[model samples]
Target: MTVTATRSRAGVLTGVLTAALVCTGLMAGIFFAFTVSVMPGLHETDDRTFVTAMRGINAAIENGLFGLVFVGALGFTGLAAVLLARSGRRAAAWWAGAAAVLYLLVLILTMGVEVPLNDQLARAGDDFARARHDFEGVWVPVNDLRTVLTALALACLGPALAKRTAGVSR
Candidate 1:
């Protein structure tokens, strides 16, 4: 490759990697917040209050800014994987690939498990007791799993970013 083209690729990759890191970090932070604060605080509330508060949170989370970061983390990580592999940076590729897979799992868990549960609870309307009974036990465990996955994904991306930076500096 020409020097200019190589520099261009490096520049784009730096942006992608930076986005991957920030987005994954933010996503992980969200899960951490829920785990350490939101859920625990919800635990102290009554059934109706818990159900209502959770419903609001679920609804609020589907906005534009959240959507951008949520999907951005996945997209950038996946791109980083392909780019690293193409450049024969196998170790960095593997790290980024793992990050992609783990983050994708987070998406799957959210869509397949969490969203449906949230929807059901929101539609429960006056059935707050039933909602709390059905949602809390199942949802909490799955959310915890996603939280761990996000954190792991970020960990993988950290190594990938370091490797990418080293390459560029060289």
Candidate 2:
């Protein structure tokens, strides 16, 4: 490839990787918030209040702002993976691709497992105590999984970004 074209490709890939890093950090922050603050706060509340609050929060998060951040993070990572796959720097490619795949697991677990639990809790009505009792057991652990995965993705993307910059400098 021409020098200009190669530089452009690296630039775009770097942008994507940076975005992936930001989004993943945001997501990890959200989960970490739940882990450290939200859930713990809920644990102190009455069961009814806990259920109501969780249901409302989950419902509110279904909006555009959250959607874009969540999906954008994944999309950028996936694009970075594709762009870097053919890069001459194998280290950059490997880390970028791994970040994409790691975040995919976070997406899958959110949609497949966490969403279902949220739905069930929403439908629980006056059985708030029981619903929450059942929900917390499964939800909290899975959330931690996503949180860790997102953090790991961030870790991988960091190195990938550094490698991209190094390539440009050399």
Q: Model 2, 20-138: lDDT tens per residue?
A: 88988899899989988998889899989999999999999999988998998889988877777666666777788899899999999999999999999988879877998989999
Candidate 2, position 105, lDDT: 95
- State the displacement of the C-alpha of residue 20, model 1, in Å, after optimal TM-score superposition: 0.7
Reference-based TM-score of each model: 0.95, 0.92
lDDT of each: 0.91, 0.86
Q: Give the per-residue lDDT digits (tens) of candidate 1, residues 133-167.
A: 99999998888998999999999998998887554
- After TM-score superposition, the amount by which residue 112's alpha carbon in candidate 1 deviates from its true location, in angstroms, is 0.5
lDDT of candidate 1 at residue 109, scale 0 to 100: 93
How many clashes in each structure?
Answer: 0, 0
Candidate 1: list runs displaced more than 4 Å: 165-170
